[model samples]
Target: MLHTDAPGNTRQNGRWSSIVLIVKMLLTVAWRNLLRNRRRSVIVFISIVVGITAVMFNDGLSIGMISQMLENSIGSHVSHIQIHAKGFNDNRVIQNNMATPSEVENVLRDTPGIAHWSPRVVSFGLLSSALNSSGGVIVGVDPEREQDVTTIRRSIVEGSYLTGAPREVVIARRLADKLQVGLGDKVVGMASALSGDVGSDLFRVTGIFETVSSEFDKAYMFTSIDNARSMLELEDRVLEYAVIVRDINEVEDIAASLRSKLGDEYEVLTYIDLLPILVSQVDMYQSMMYVVYLIIALAMIFGIINTMLMSVFERIQEFGVLMAIGMRVRRIFLMVLLEAGMLGVLGTAVGLLLGSGLLLLFSHIGIDFSIFSEGLTSFGVGAVIYPRLTPDTILNVLIIIPLTTVLGAVYPAVRAMRLQPVAAIRYV
Candidate 1:
């Protein structure tokens, strides 16, 4: 019994060793076949390279552009989160001012993640210089604290930021242009008061600021919170609290905690909530990119199919000879599949390296769209965009390209495996 078992085990080992050798030889042949038609293989290789490179470049650009827009919006005035009276964001009415300022202020001060907070008075009103008049949103802010929360102070291009002095106003450069006013010019602001009566005040254009957004430039005017309260007849009350967090990524968690503390009367909103359109642009770009990936993959699939079919057809006689010499039929199928996969992997590797290099280079140097600054400014994106590489984008490239090529080779592989040895050998 021991002797019989030993012989059977030996035979099994020999059979496995032969199978390994055959597979190794088939792999070598598959690779050689690709080299045999170098022109076709190189052409297919270039196509895959171009497709992958294009995908990476597009993804990087879109991510960079949207990210800059979000940062610009937040830094301009949105901040990380905002605490507003229940109806204030939607209605912008003085009647919707925070009902209990002390309570809300206490909650914010106690909040662990809040880095800085500033009270604001917001209203829609008209600013008229003697030469012209433009309607815009008026925001009242604490000069010192607002500087801690927003970048408007730094964005003052032509004049100084607000000093919290009596009746001081800061207008956008574009708005200043529209009103035919400049620094030290006088302007009158008019708005509806909490008492349902029209409120008006005269202000000096102490500063002019130019932010990334042309729309924001033309649509907002800022002044001291004291002056704004006096103008709108909402003394010692505020409509919103603009907040900045120590870590922006933790904004949602902090906002949730604030909501629970402050209750339902006040709305605790993150930048994601306050700037939905800008935030949604990231998701929209990602969704649209999948369509782009599919188009590129489909193009590669057809290219791979055409190339593999040609390789299979040109080697039909050689395949017949292999089968006649006792090579298994399935080896032919695997060989073709292997060839296609090798082509894909080689192309994808070169493409990924090239694409990642481009992304890395541009990430530091940045791409300047300054020539089209007007169009980008309208969308609230800056002129210079620094490309970013995400793990998910890299993962997509690793998974899609090789799989597409392998799937495309199925038909050619099947045809090669189905060849009849005798008939194939007898062919001319």
Candidate 2:
């Protein structure tokens, strides 16, 4: 019994050794086959590199563009969160203004995540200059607090931000151009007060600003809170309280906390809620990327299938010889698959290195599209975009490339496995 068990163990050990040897042999042969056809392999490799590089570059650009849009919109106007009187968003009437300014201020000041907060008196009115008139939103802000909450102060292209001087106003560059008004020019604004009286005021354009969003630049104007209160006939009432958080990503959490603490009298909204158009644009861009990736994958699939088919046909006699010398059909199939996988691995590695290097270089220098500045600004995107890459994108590429290669090699691998040794050898 002991002798018999010893013989069985020896046989099992030999079988394991043979499996390892077969795997090593298969890998070596696959490596050799890739090297044997230098030109063809290089052609396939280059195609894959080009495809991957294009994908990475386009993805990076899309991400950068979206990021810039969000940054501009948030920094320029939205802040991270906004607190408003219920129903104020739907109607711009003075009656819908925030009634408890002190309570809102207390909550903001007490909030741990709050970076800055500013109360604003917002109203819709017709702004008129000597040359032109347009309907726009007039926002009254606190100069010092507003500067902390937004980049409006920094965006001043000409003139200065509100100085609390009586009737001092800040207008956008586009509005200034259309109105044909320069710094110190007087502009008139007309609106209806909550008391059902026509309210009108004369404003001196003390500052001009340019922002990434053309719509915002053309449709908004600002003044000191004191001037707005006087013009709108309001007493210490604000339409909205805009709050900036330390981290933009934590805005929703902060908003939720504010909502619970402030009770139902005030409505708390994050930037995403305030800017639905921007949210929709981001979703649309992400959906479009899916289509783009699908197209790229299809292109890669076809190219790989063509290359693998050629490789299989070229190695027909060699495969037949192997089968004739006792190689199993499954091993033949596996070898073909291995070759395709090796190609994918090589191509993907080189592509990632090249693409990442290019992205890093461009991220610092940025890609300038100043020629399309007008169009880019219309979408609230900067003319110079700094490319970005996320870990999810890299993981997707790593998974997709190998899967694409395997799918492309399936038919060729099966064909190689199904070959009749005698017929294949004779035909070749």
Candidate 3:
């Protein structure tokens, strides 16, 4: 038993040692082959670098736009989540208002992830200045509490936010311009009161705000909660509760918790639900990225195949000599694959470094698309976008490079393996 075990162990060790030697030889040959044709190798490397850089830059831009859209939406008014009375979003009537705002506030205060919240009274109404009138959504909010949930206070470009004074209001700059109104100017608001009567009131424009979305700027206005209650005759009632979470990632979970706690009377919605157009835009961009990747992969595959095929043809005599000198057909195939693999490794490494460096540099300075500012602002995205590189993007690139290399080598490797030593050696 001892003798038999010794022989088996020796055979296994020899097999492993043979594998190690073959790998070392293949690597050495591969490295030499790549260096032999410097111009061809450089061309292939440049193609890979360009392809990778384009993909990374484009991906960063897309991500940046999406990030900015989300930030602007959250800062403008959407917050992370909103709790509204059932069917309130569909029909913005006084009847659909939240009756127990105090109870909702208590629940929000008790919630673990709730960072800040503000109760709002939302109403669609006709707003008019002395010279012009336009239809707009009137938002009533607590001066101090609203600051934590929205950036309305910070977005005030002129004058100041609602100071809790009776009849004080804030208008977006676009709306203010359309109405020909400015600071301390009076704007009349007309909306349906709880009694089904047309409630009208005069409010002094205390502030003018400018947000990313021009449409939002023109369609929304704000006033103190008390004044809104008086104008809409909604005593102590609110339309919704805007909530900001401590962590944006935890928004869905917190919304679920709030839904379960609040029961069926209230409907909790995340920004994704509230802003379906934005969600769709993000999804569309993500889908487009896959198509872009496919195109890039095809370009890379063709480039590699062309380079490897050329290398195989040029080294035909060498492969014939190696095979004639007792190297196996499988080894020849492996050598061809190794050469292609090495090229891919070197190119991809350099490309990744270059792309990552560019992304890092641009992330700080940001890309200014001020030329398309009007179009971007219409979609709630800012002109200056800060590029972002996610872990997923890096992972995708890593996985694609090796797979592309292997795919590109298969035909060339197979061609090398099928070569008859005598025929290959005799060929001109």
What are the models' TM-scores?
A: 0.91, 0.94, 0.94
Candidate 2, residues 1-428: lDDT per residue as tens digits? 77876855674547889889888899899989999998988998888777777888888888889989998898888888988998787776888987669988988889988999999998888999988999888888998899998889999989888888899999998988888899999999988776778788999999999998897899889998888888888889999998989988788889999999989888888989988988898889888877887888888888878888999998888888999999999999989888888888888898888878888788889999999999999988868989888675677678787778777888899999999999888865
Whole-model Cα lDDT per candidate? 0.90, 0.87, 0.88
**lDDT tens per residue, model 1, 1-428:** 77876855674547889889877887899889999999999999999999999999998888888888888888888999999989777877889998578999999899898999999999998889999999988899999999999888999988899999988889988999999999999999999998999999999998999998888898888999999999888989999999999998899899999999999899888999999887788799989889988999999999999999999888888889999988888888989999999998998899999999999899899999999999999998878888888787788999999999999999999998998988777766
Q: Write the per-residue lDDT of candidate 3 for residues 1-428, one digit (tens) a residue.
A: 67876755674547889899899989999889989998998898788878888898888889888988988998899989999999887776888988888878889999999999999988898999999999998999999999988989999999998889999999999999999999999999999998899988999998999988887898889999888999888999999899999999998999999999898998899999999988898899989987888899898889889999999999898889998998999988888888878877877788788888888888999888899999988888878888888776777777787678768888999999999999988866
**Alpha carbon lDDT at 50, candidate 2:** 79
Q: Where in model 1 is the C-alpha error above 4 Å?
A: 1-25
Identify the runs in model 3 with alpha carbons over 4 angstroms from their true place: 1-13
**lDDT of candidate 3 vs native?**
0.88
For model 2 the local lDDT of residue 80 reads 88
